[model samples]
Target: MKENRSREMYEEIKNITKTFQPRLGVIKDEKGNILTESKQIVDRWKRYCEKMYSSDSTADQQEKLEETREDKEINLLPLRSEIEWAIGSLKDGKSPGCDDI
Candidate 1:
């Protein structure tokens, strides 16, 4: 019947996530120390994700697009009568925006 009630609700949510044991409660460090074991909270989340994606310098610190100026004027091509007035203001079977078209 609905695939055996979705395979008995996926084996009762995989045996309630195999007896579930997730608490990760204490974790502090960055000199403030606390942690609490499970291998020092997995080596403090692998040294805070390797110091948040380690990058001392692979150059390009940014800034040049002719040094940057345009506080306003930014047309970048839309006008075909503004894409036919946004497909004539959408409404038949709606949903399209967020590039979901």
Candidate 2:
């Protein structure tokens, strides 16, 4: 269920980003490492969500935000804690229904 929600949000963000086409300005992270994972996702989202395009600052920034929104692979904006708990349960073999990993 959570995976499905994550996929849905991902698709929605992808659609929005392609529609905006932000220039991505630049993407070096705090450690001076170009967040390659984020950069890759941003690039793909831009290509995927192109409802229309314009040479305006707002559009580009919106796209950039939407594209770069995902901080980590497992993070879905709406279900972070739920997913985290599930993972913790799995790690501890405490999930009530699952017999094995």
Each model's TM-score, in the order given? 0.25, 0.18
Q: After the best TM-score superposition of candidate 1, give how far the Cα of residue 47 lies from its true spot, in angstroms.
A: 8.6
What tens digits encode model 1's per-residue C-alpha lDDT throughout 61-90?
233343454444577788799999999998
lDDT per residue for candidate 2 within 1-101, as digits (tens), equals 46559888988888888765566545654345564576665765574354235456568888888888664566537678888887776755354675664
lDDT of 2 at 8: 86
Which one is best on TM-score? 1
Residue pairs with backbone atoms closer than 3 Å in model 1 (clashes): none
lDDT of each: 0.73, 0.64
lDDT of 1: 0.73
